[model samples]
Target: MKKIAILLALSVALSAPAWAATKAVTLSISGMTCGVCPITVRTALQRVPGVEKVGIDEAKKQVTITYDYSKTNVQALTRATKDAGYPSSIKQGERDHG
Candidate 1:
Protein backbone atom coordinates (compact mmCIF):
# COMPACT_ATOMS: atom_id res chain seq x y z
CA MET A 1 0.00 0.00 0.00
CA LYS A 2 2.86 2.43 0.79
CA LYS A 3 4.50 1.71 -2.55
CA ILE A 4 1.26 2.36 -4.40
CA ALA A 5 0.79 5.66 -2.52
CA ILE A 6 4.33 6.75 -3.39
CA LEU A 7 3.75 5.92 -7.05
CA LEU A 8 0.54 7.93 -7.11
CA ALA A 9 2.23 10.95 -5.51
CA LEU A 10 5.08 10.78 -8.00
CA SER A 11 2.67 10.58 -10.89
CA VAL A 12 0.76 13.58 -9.61
CA ALA A 13 3.92 15.63 -9.30
CA LEU A 14 5.10 14.67 -12.76
CA SER A 15 1.74 15.49 -14.34
CA ALA A 16 1.55 18.94 -12.84
CA PRO A 17 1.76 21.75 -15.36
CA ALA A 18 4.99 23.65 -15.51
CA TRP A 19 4.96 27.42 -15.47
CA ALA A 20 6.40 28.74 -18.68
CA ALA A 21 8.45 31.90 -18.62
CA THR A 22 8.38 34.65 -21.21
CA LYS A 23 10.18 34.31 -24.56
CA ALA A 24 12.51 36.90 -26.06
CA VAL A 25 12.85 38.34 -29.53
CA THR A 26 15.45 40.70 -30.93
CA LEU A 27 14.43 43.50 -33.30
CA SER A 28 16.68 45.63 -35.45
CA ILE A 29 15.73 49.27 -35.22
CA SER A 30 16.49 52.23 -37.44
CA GLY A 31 16.79 55.98 -36.84
CA MET A 32 17.73 55.85 -33.15
CA THR A 33 20.27 58.68 -32.91
CA CYS A 34 20.52 59.28 -29.17
CA GLY A 35 19.81 58.06 -25.65
CA VAL A 36 16.15 59.04 -25.69
CA CYS A 37 15.45 56.47 -28.39
CA PRO A 38 16.10 53.51 -26.11
CA ILE A 39 13.88 54.97 -23.45
CA THR A 40 11.13 55.44 -25.96
CA VAL A 41 11.37 51.84 -27.08
CA ARG A 42 11.38 50.57 -23.51
CA THR A 43 8.34 52.63 -22.60
CA ALA A 44 6.29 51.39 -25.50
CA LEU A 45 7.11 47.75 -24.88
CA GLN A 46 6.40 48.05 -21.16
CA ARG A 47 2.84 48.99 -21.93
CA VAL A 48 2.20 45.40 -22.88
CA PRO A 49 0.95 43.50 -19.85
CA GLY A 50 3.27 40.51 -20.01
CA VAL A 51 6.46 42.15 -21.23
CA GLU A 52 8.94 41.06 -18.58
CA LYS A 53 12.11 42.76 -19.77
CA VAL A 54 13.63 44.91 -22.54
CA GLY A 55 17.23 45.50 -23.53
CA ILE A 56 18.37 47.91 -26.22
CA ASP A 57 21.74 47.94 -27.90
CA GLU A 58 22.26 51.49 -29.10
CA ALA A 59 25.43 50.70 -31.04
CA LYS A 60 23.80 47.72 -32.72
CA LYS A 61 20.40 49.45 -32.92
CA GLN A 62 18.73 46.30 -31.74
CA VAL A 63 16.15 45.70 -29.00
CA THR A 64 15.96 42.40 -27.17
CA ILE A 65 12.55 41.98 -25.59
CA THR A 66 11.36 39.22 -23.28
CA TYR A 67 7.58 38.95 -23.32
CA ASP A 68 4.83 36.47 -22.66
CA TYR A 69 3.59 35.24 -26.00
CA SER A 70 0.24 34.46 -24.49
CA LYS A 71 -0.26 38.20 -24.04
CA THR A 72 1.48 39.67 -27.12
CA ASN A 73 3.15 38.85 -30.44
CA VAL A 74 5.94 39.92 -32.79
CA GLN A 75 3.67 42.27 -34.75
CA ALA A 76 2.60 44.02 -31.58
CA LEU A 77 6.22 44.46 -30.50
CA THR A 78 7.25 45.85 -33.90
CA ARG A 79 4.34 48.26 -33.82
CA ALA A 80 5.37 49.45 -30.38
CA THR A 81 8.82 50.30 -31.68
CA LYS A 82 7.39 52.14 -34.68
CA ASP A 83 5.09 54.18 -32.50
CA ALA A 84 8.06 55.17 -30.35
CA GLY A 85 9.63 57.08 -33.32
CA TYR A 86 12.18 54.35 -33.99
CA PRO A 87 10.83 52.06 -36.64
CA SER A 88 12.05 48.45 -36.41
CA SER A 89 12.07 45.14 -38.19
CA ILE A 90 12.67 41.54 -37.19
CA LYS A 91 16.26 40.57 -37.95
CA GLN A 92 16.06 37.81 -40.51
CA GLY A 93 19.75 37.19 -41.12
CA GLU A 94 23.13 38.91 -41.17
CA ARG A 95 21.98 42.24 -42.51
CA ASP A 96 23.47 45.73 -42.68
CA HIS A 97 22.85 47.96 -39.68
CA GLY A 98 20.45 50.77 -40.38
Candidate 2:
Protein backbone atom coordinates (compact mmCIF):
# COMPACT_ATOMS: atom_id res chain seq x y z
CA MET A 1 0.00 0.00 0.00
CA LYS A 2 2.85 2.43 0.81
CA LYS A 3 4.57 1.68 -2.47
CA ILE A 4 1.37 2.28 -4.41
CA ALA A 5 0.83 5.57 -2.62
CA ILE A 6 4.36 6.71 -3.40
CA LEU A 7 3.93 5.84 -7.04
CA LEU A 8 0.67 7.74 -7.19
CA ALA A 9 2.25 10.81 -5.62
CA LEU A 10 5.13 10.68 -8.06
CA SER A 11 2.77 10.43 -11.00
CA VAL A 12 0.76 13.40 -9.79
CA ALA A 13 3.84 15.51 -9.38
CA LEU A 14 5.07 14.64 -12.85
CA SER A 15 1.71 15.53 -14.38
CA ALA A 16 1.50 18.94 -12.76
CA PRO A 17 1.40 21.97 -14.98
CA ALA A 18 4.66 23.62 -15.88
CA TRP A 19 4.47 27.38 -15.59
CA ALA A 20 6.15 29.21 -18.43
CA ALA A 21 8.43 32.17 -18.10
CA THR A 22 7.54 35.60 -19.45
CA LYS A 23 9.25 36.69 -22.65
CA ALA A 24 9.49 39.92 -24.59
CA VAL A 25 10.24 40.70 -28.20
CA THR A 26 10.52 43.79 -30.36
CA LEU A 27 9.18 44.00 -33.87
CA SER A 28 9.71 46.46 -36.68
CA ILE A 29 6.31 47.56 -37.95
CA SER A 30 5.26 48.83 -41.34
CA GLY A 31 2.29 50.89 -42.65
CA MET A 32 1.90 52.95 -39.48
CA THR A 33 1.56 56.40 -41.01
CA CYS A 34 -1.06 58.16 -38.92
CA GLY A 35 -1.70 59.01 -35.31
CA VAL A 36 -4.11 56.11 -34.80
CA CYS A 37 -1.54 53.58 -35.89
CA PRO A 38 -0.10 52.94 -32.47
CA ILE A 39 -3.48 52.42 -30.95
CA THR A 40 -4.34 49.92 -33.59
CA VAL A 41 -1.09 48.09 -33.12
CA ARG A 42 -1.45 47.99 -29.36
CA THR A 43 -4.96 46.64 -29.56
CA ALA A 44 -3.94 43.94 -31.98
CA LEU A 45 -1.06 42.78 -29.83
CA GLN A 46 -3.09 42.84 -26.63
CA ARG A 47 -5.68 40.55 -28.11
CA VAL A 48 -3.24 37.70 -28.42
CA PRO A 49 -3.37 35.17 -25.57
CA GLY A 50 -0.60 35.55 -22.96
CA VAL A 51 0.31 39.08 -24.00
CA GLU A 52 1.03 40.98 -20.82
CA LYS A 53 2.20 44.39 -22.03
CA VAL A 54 2.81 46.28 -25.24
CA GLY A 55 4.94 49.35 -25.93
CA ILE A 56 4.90 51.19 -29.20
CA ASP A 57 7.47 53.61 -30.57
CA GLU A 58 5.96 55.57 -33.41
CA ALA A 59 9.07 57.49 -34.37
CA LYS A 60 11.10 54.33 -34.46
CA LYS A 61 8.28 52.25 -35.96
CA GLN A 62 8.75 49.50 -33.46
CA VAL A 63 6.75 47.67 -30.80
CA THR A 64 7.89 45.64 -27.83
CA ILE A 65 5.58 42.97 -26.44
CA THR A 66 5.74 40.92 -23.26
CA TYR A 67 3.98 37.58 -23.17
CA ASP A 68 3.94 34.13 -21.62
CA TYR A 69 6.31 31.85 -23.51
CA SER A 70 4.08 28.78 -23.25
CA LYS A 71 1.03 30.51 -24.64
CA THR A 72 2.55 32.59 -27.44
CA ASN A 73 5.60 33.19 -29.60
CA VAL A 74 7.14 35.71 -31.99
CA GLN A 75 5.28 34.22 -34.93
CA ALA A 76 1.97 34.74 -33.14
CA LEU A 77 2.91 38.32 -32.32
CA THR A 78 3.81 39.13 -35.91
CA ARG A 79 0.65 37.43 -37.15
CA ALA A 80 -1.49 39.54 -34.85
CA THR A 81 -0.01 42.74 -36.23
CA LYS A 82 -0.40 41.60 -39.80
CA ASP A 83 -4.03 40.76 -39.20
CA ALA A 84 -4.51 44.28 -37.89
CA GLY A 85 -3.24 45.71 -41.21
CA TYR A 86 0.27 46.55 -40.02
CA PRO A 87 2.60 43.69 -40.85
CA SER A 88 5.71 43.29 -38.71
CA SER A 89 8.96 41.37 -38.37
CA ILE A 90 11.30 40.82 -35.45
CA LYS A 91 13.61 43.82 -35.04
CA GLN A 92 17.06 42.92 -36.29
CA GLY A 93 19.65 42.13 -33.61
CA GLU A 94 16.98 41.87 -30.94
CA ARG A 95 16.28 38.42 -29.55
CA ASP A 96 13.37 37.26 -27.41
CA HIS A 97 13.89 38.47 -23.84
CA GLY A 98 12.66 37.16 -20.54
Candidate 3:
Protein backbone atom coordinates (compact mmCIF):
# COMPACT_ATOMS: atom_id res chain seq x y z
CA MET A 1 0.00 0.00 0.00
CA LYS A 2 2.82 2.42 0.76
CA LYS A 3 4.50 1.66 -2.54
CA ILE A 4 1.27 2.27 -4.40
CA ALA A 5 0.82 5.61 -2.66
CA ILE A 6 4.32 6.67 -3.48
CA LEU A 7 3.85 5.79 -7.14
CA LEU A 8 0.63 7.76 -7.27
CA ALA A 9 2.32 10.81 -5.84
CA LEU A 10 5.17 10.56 -8.32
CA SER A 11 2.79 10.27 -11.20
CA VAL A 12 0.83 13.30 -10.08
CA ALA A 13 4.00 15.33 -9.81
CA LEU A 14 5.16 14.32 -13.26
CA SER A 15 1.80 15.17 -14.80
CA ALA A 16 1.82 18.74 -13.62
CA PRO A 17 1.73 21.13 -16.56
CA ALA A 18 4.65 23.33 -17.53
CA TRP A 19 2.44 26.32 -17.03
CA ALA A 20 2.81 25.77 -13.32
CA ALA A 21 5.95 27.90 -13.59
CA THR A 22 4.85 31.49 -13.28
CA LYS A 23 6.86 34.69 -13.81
CA ALA A 24 6.37 38.36 -13.17
CA VAL A 25 7.63 41.30 -15.19
CA THR A 26 7.27 45.03 -15.09
CA LEU A 27 6.70 46.99 -18.29
CA SER A 28 6.92 50.65 -19.14
CA ILE A 29 4.03 51.76 -21.29
CA SER A 30 3.82 54.67 -23.67
CA GLY A 31 0.98 56.71 -25.13
CA MET A 32 -1.05 56.52 -21.94
CA THR A 33 -2.30 60.06 -22.03
CA CYS A 34 -5.58 59.71 -20.22
CA GLY A 35 -7.57 57.49 -17.85
CA VAL A 36 -9.07 55.28 -20.55
CA CYS A 37 -5.63 54.20 -21.73
CA PRO A 38 -5.12 52.05 -18.67
CA ILE A 39 -8.49 50.39 -19.13
CA THR A 40 -7.62 49.57 -22.70
CA VAL A 41 -4.24 48.21 -21.76
CA ARG A 42 -5.68 46.04 -19.01
CA THR A 43 -8.34 44.64 -21.28
CA ALA A 44 -5.83 43.78 -23.94
CA LEU A 45 -3.47 42.07 -21.48
CA GLN A 46 -6.26 40.08 -19.82
CA ARG A 47 -7.22 38.67 -23.18
CA VAL A 48 -3.87 36.87 -23.27
CA PRO A 49 -4.23 33.19 -22.43
CA GLY A 50 -1.69 32.79 -19.62
CA VAL A 51 -1.78 36.12 -17.87
CA GLU A 52 -2.47 35.34 -14.22
CA LYS A 53 -2.45 38.85 -12.78
CA VAL A 54 -2.02 42.44 -13.92
CA GLY A 55 -1.21 45.42 -11.72
CA ILE A 56 -1.29 48.79 -13.36
CA ASP A 57 0.21 52.02 -12.07
CA GLU A 58 -1.29 54.73 -14.16
CA ALA A 59 0.60 57.43 -12.36
CA LYS A 60 3.89 55.85 -13.39
CA LYS A 61 2.79 54.56 -16.77
CA GLN A 62 3.88 51.11 -15.82
CA VAL A 63 2.31 47.71 -15.32
CA THR A 64 3.35 44.52 -13.62
CA ILE A 65 2.12 41.24 -14.99
CA THR A 66 2.33 37.76 -13.58
CA TYR A 67 1.95 35.13 -16.26
CA ASP A 68 2.43 31.45 -16.96
CA TYR A 69 5.78 31.29 -18.69
CA SER A 70 5.06 28.10 -20.57
CA LYS A 71 1.95 29.51 -22.20
CA THR A 72 3.04 33.06 -22.91
CA ASN A 73 6.15 35.25 -23.24
CA VAL A 74 7.36 38.83 -22.99
CA GLN A 75 6.92 39.38 -26.69
CA ALA A 76 3.29 38.39 -26.49
CA LEU A 77 2.71 40.76 -23.61
CA THR A 78 4.33 43.64 -25.46
CA ARG A 79 2.32 42.84 -28.55
CA ALA A 80 -0.91 42.87 -26.62
CA THR A 81 -0.22 46.33 -25.30
CA LYS A 82 0.88 47.56 -28.70
CA ASP A 83 -2.29 46.27 -30.29
CA ALA A 84 -4.29 48.15 -27.72
CA GLY A 85 -2.57 51.36 -28.90
CA TYR A 86 -0.24 51.51 -25.90
CA PRO A 87 3.23 50.35 -26.71
CA SER A 88 5.21 48.71 -23.94
CA SER A 89 8.60 47.26 -23.18
CA ILE A 90 10.27 45.59 -20.26
CA LYS A 91 11.26 48.13 -17.65
CA GLN A 92 14.96 48.86 -17.55
CA GLY A 93 16.98 46.64 -15.25
CA GLU A 94 13.88 44.62 -14.40
CA ARG A 95 14.42 40.92 -14.81
CA ASP A 96 11.99 38.04 -14.78
CA HIS A 97 10.85 37.16 -11.29
CA GLY A 98 9.17 33.87 -10.68
Candidate 4:
Protein backbone atom coordinates (compact mmCIF):
# COMPACT_ATOMS: atom_id res chain seq x y z
CA MET A 1 0.00 0.00 0.00
CA LYS A 2 2.86 2.42 0.79
CA LYS A 3 4.48 1.71 -2.57
CA ILE A 4 1.23 2.29 -4.39
CA ALA A 5 0.73 5.64 -2.61
CA ILE A 6 4.27 6.74 -3.47
CA LEU A 7 3.75 5.88 -7.15
CA LEU A 8 0.51 7.78 -7.26
CA ALA A 9 2.15 10.87 -5.78
CA LEU A 10 4.98 10.67 -8.27
CA SER A 11 2.60 10.35 -11.16
CA VAL A 12 0.60 13.34 -10.03
CA ALA A 13 3.73 15.44 -9.73
CA LEU A 14 4.90 14.46 -13.19
CA SER A 15 1.52 15.13 -14.76
CA ALA A 16 1.14 18.60 -13.31
CA PRO A 17 1.60 21.48 -15.74
CA ALA A 18 5.20 22.65 -16.03
CA TRP A 19 4.23 25.96 -17.56
CA ALA A 20 4.24 27.92 -14.33
CA ALA A 21 7.51 29.66 -15.17
CA THR A 22 6.77 33.36 -15.65
CA LYS A 23 8.89 36.00 -17.36
CA ALA A 24 8.60 39.73 -16.84
CA VAL A 25 10.14 42.28 -19.17
CA THR A 26 9.91 45.93 -19.97
CA LEU A 27 9.25 46.65 -23.64
CA SER A 28 10.03 49.90 -25.36
CA ILE A 29 7.09 50.80 -27.54
CA SER A 30 7.43 53.12 -30.46
CA GLY A 31 4.76 55.04 -32.42
CA MET A 32 2.54 55.98 -29.49
CA THR A 33 1.81 59.62 -30.26
CA CYS A 34 -1.61 60.32 -28.79
CA GLY A 35 -3.93 59.77 -25.86
CA VAL A 36 -5.43 56.64 -27.36
CA CYS A 37 -2.03 55.02 -27.94
CA PRO A 38 -1.88 53.37 -24.55
CA ILE A 39 -5.26 51.79 -25.01
CA THR A 40 -4.19 50.31 -28.29
CA VAL A 41 -0.93 49.04 -26.85
CA ARG A 42 -2.65 47.48 -23.86
CA THR A 43 -5.20 45.77 -26.04
CA ALA A 44 -2.51 44.45 -28.33
CA LEU A 45 -0.46 43.03 -25.48
CA GLN A 46 -3.44 41.47 -23.73
CA ARG A 47 -4.27 39.54 -26.87
CA VAL A 48 -1.14 37.45 -26.56
CA PRO A 49 -1.96 33.87 -25.54
CA GLY A 50 0.16 33.65 -22.40
CA VAL A 51 0.33 37.26 -21.33
CA GLU A 52 -0.66 37.38 -17.68
CA LYS A 53 -0.33 41.13 -17.06
CA VAL A 54 0.37 44.35 -18.89
CA GLY A 55 1.49 47.71 -17.53
CA ILE A 56 1.69 50.67 -19.88
CA ASP A 57 3.17 54.11 -19.44
CA GLU A 58 2.20 56.36 -22.30
CA ALA A 59 4.55 59.16 -21.34
CA LYS A 60 7.53 56.86 -21.28
CA LYS A 61 6.35 54.81 -24.26
CA GLN A 62 6.98 51.63 -22.34
CA VAL A 63 4.99 48.52 -21.56
CA THR A 64 5.79 45.87 -19.00
CA ILE A 65 4.53 42.40 -19.72
CA THR A 66 4.40 39.24 -17.64
CA TYR A 67 3.64 35.98 -19.36
CA ASP A 68 4.02 32.22 -19.22
CA TYR A 69 7.44 31.27 -20.54
CA SER A 70 6.45 27.85 -21.81
CA LYS A 71 3.51 28.96 -23.94
CA THR A 72 5.07 32.11 -25.37
CA ASN A 73 8.38 33.82 -25.97
CA VAL A 74 9.75 37.31 -26.52
CA GLN A 75 9.40 37.15 -30.30
CA ALA A 76 5.72 36.34 -30.10
CA LEU A 77 5.15 39.19 -27.68
CA THR A 78 6.94 41.67 -29.91
CA ARG A 79 5.08 40.42 -32.94
CA ALA A 80 1.75 40.82 -31.25
CA THR A 81 2.49 44.38 -30.27
CA LYS A 82 3.78 45.24 -33.72
CA ASP A 83 0.79 43.68 -35.36
CA ALA A 84 -1.36 45.92 -33.22
CA GLY A 85 0.40 48.98 -34.69
CA TYR A 86 2.74 49.50 -31.74
CA PRO A 87 6.20 48.16 -32.43
CA SER A 88 8.02 46.85 -29.36
CA SER A 89 11.51 45.90 -28.36
CA ILE A 90 12.64 44.09 -25.24
CA LYS A 91 14.63 46.20 -22.83
CA GLN A 92 18.12 45.40 -21.64
CA GLY A 93 17.17 43.61 -18.43
CA GLU A 94 14.58 40.94 -17.77
CA ARG A 95 12.85 39.78 -14.59
CA ASP A 96 11.84 36.25 -13.76
CA HIS A 97 8.76 35.70 -11.60
CA GLY A 98 8.64 32.22 -10.17
Global lDDT scores for all candidate models: 0.80, 0.92, 0.92, 0.83
Off by over 4 Å in 1: 1-18, 94-98
Residues 16-88, candidate 3, lDDT per residue (tens digit)?
A: 9742999999999968889899899999999999999999998889999999999999999999999888889
- How many pairs of residues collide in each model? 0, 0, 0, 0
Candidate 1 lDDT (Cα, 0 to 1): 0.80
Encode model 1's per-residue lDDT on 1-98: one tens digit a residue: 99999999998888753444567888898787888888888999899777888888999888888887777887888888888777898876733221
Q: Candidates 3 and 4: which is better by TM-score?
A: 3
Q: Which of candidates 2 and 4 is the stronger one according to TM-score?
A: 2
TM-score of each: 0.72, 0.79, 0.83, 0.76
Q: What lDDT does model 4 reach?
A: 0.83
The true-versus-predicted C-alpha distance at residue 59 of model 1, in Å, is 0.4
Candidate 3: Cα lDDT at 18: 49
> How do the candidates rank by TM-score, highest first?
3, 2, 4, 1
Report the candidate with higher lDDT, 1 versus 2. Answer: 2
Please, what are the lDDT tens digits per residue for candidate 4 over residues 1-98?
A: 99999999998899766637788888888788899998888888888888999998888888888889888888998898889888888765654444
Question: Number of clashes in model 4?
Answer: 0
lDDT of 2 by residue, 1-98 (tens): 99999999998888754445899999999788899999999999999999999999999999999999888999999999999999999999989989
Order of all candidates by lDDT, from best down to worst? 3, 2, 4, 1
